[model samples]
Target: MTQPDNTDDALIRLFNVSKRFGAKLALSNITMDIHKGEWLYVTGPSGAGKSTLLKLFYLGEKTTSGQVLVFGTNMNRLARREIPFLRRRFGIIFQDFKLIAHRNVFENVALVLEARGEPRAMIAKRTRNILRHAGMEMRMNAMPTTLSGGEQQRVAVARAIAGQPEVILADEPTGSLDPKSAEIIIGLLSAYHKRGATVLVATHDTELLARREGRIIRLEEGRLVSSEPAVGEAP
Candidate 1:
């Protein structure tokens, strides 16, 4: 297996990290580094620990052994109260597009800025801009349940990016969308990555990987099998 990147300036680092659920070893001896302003793809079959890996970065799941460091702090030792602060530095997109059914698109997107205590006017302005970018401006007042799958995902994207986080962790972001919708989602992420945010996408879609250019890492049975640049790219 190829060695994981371990540069000094890594924004996120996983060192010999392992996670177990009961008797199942979900992730094994993983060591990887995510650098600032880089786009990374984590690819593997279902249950290969792709989602678990992303969760570990944001503290959704703890490692059974070893350490996960993000933004210079060891997550294994971070206080519960401090997790939220660290999460604020990350924008996470889930496969299910977990939007609140009762909240309108505008409210959903604005909640992030509101949580950060931004001025109401600023929140309104930024939320509107982000919705427009996600092509959800017209649906801003609509409930998430009222939107189509693609539309709802767009709203989720808007919500994820409203805070301008330093890192974006997307887990199977396009797994359920049509080709066109998936393209839009990938486009949004690509645009975000261009703005200097580090992006880590966990997907098993070969077509999606074929269409994007980034470093690719493959996992098999919880073990990292390869880490290499995209095809046609230089090492």
Candidate 2:
């Protein structure tokens, strides 16, 4: 696949990319551009390589072939010491809601600021503000184990947005939530997108894919089969 011709404003680009796990090819010859401030959804059935695609963006897994550029820097060329810096520009939400088991809600969100060496006062203020906005403020002192799936996902979102990252990469963020919970999670991501952050969500949810605003890219057997505006959307 060839990349989009006009990528001057792209935030991430993948050129002739492929990924393999042992003998299985997870993604094959994927060339695409994720533009700045564009909301995108990577949709496919299970094992369609949606997760692998998102991982490549964050360098959680390197490509077996070709190049990936984020913010115009080649991911393959990024030094080991510089990986953290590259990641700081992204806020990732995992399907499992990877919060530290022992950390309270406040501590979990504050951890991002702490890693960036934010002052205690600043971390507290930022963490509290995001949590309050996420409707998790009342659970600030609660442990992950005590929260329901919905609450845990909310906390995970709070943590992701605490640093005001430039891009958000969410892998099945609402996979385990009820319909109402899913709405809340998507709404939060949408709010961030409206604020100028680029957002990409990998989901298999039919309802989510039906949303009319985002650009939807569908994958099948590791190949990009379609790229189109959401239903009822123009272009």
Candidate 3:
């Protein structure tokens, strides 16, 4: 494993974290640090615990033991009211896209701003800008079911980035798209990473894994099997 920098700058940290769902151990003792402004890939095969780890980061799932700290606060100890505040700092892209089936693209993305209590005018402005960035401007008023898989994923990306959060957590973002659409999704995430947002992606796609560059961590049966800097990024 690559030794995490022993500084006070990590954006996310896990210390001997473990999670269990009934009799099955979903994740074993895992210790890792995701630094600010870094791009990280969590890669593993099916049932290898990739999704579980990402869930832990966003507090969608809690650890059975040890601790998780985000933006310097121990999430395990955070009050329920505080979880939303912490989540606002993260943009999560789900494998299923997770869009509101009843809402139009514009309204879907606008919901992010709405949750934060932004005024109507600013929500309209930001939502339009981000949808444009994702190449979904023309589909602003279209419903999710009317769009193609790639288009829907683009909408999801737009929503994730609409808030310009400090961190982006994506799970199998391209798992369902064709090659070209997959490229577009990953490219968008890379653009954000280049602009200094911390990013963590979990996937098992080898081709997708080969095309990107970042910190690569592999998991096997819930164990941290490998951690290394991207090919050109090694110190």
Off by over 4 Å in 3: 1-4
Clashes of each: 0, 0, 0
- For all predicted structures, in order, the TM-scores are 0.96, 0.97, 0.97
Q: For candidate 3, what is the lDDT? A: 0.90
lDDT of 3 at 229: 85
Model 1 residue 70 lDDT?
93
Q: lDDT of each model, Cα atoms only?
A: 0.91, 0.91, 0.90
> How good is model 1 by TM-score?
0.96
In model 2, the Cα lDDT at residue 173 comes to 97
lDDT of 3 by residue, 1-235 (tens): 4345666879888888889999998899998898999888999888889999999987999999988888988978989999898889999998889999999999999999999999999999999999999999999999999999999999999999888899999999999999999999998998888989998999988897786678889999998999878778865
Cα RMSD of all models vs. native, in order, equals: 1.3, 1.2, 1.3
Tens digit of per-residue lDDT, candidate 2, span 118-191: 99998998888999999999989999999999999999998888889999999999999999999999999999
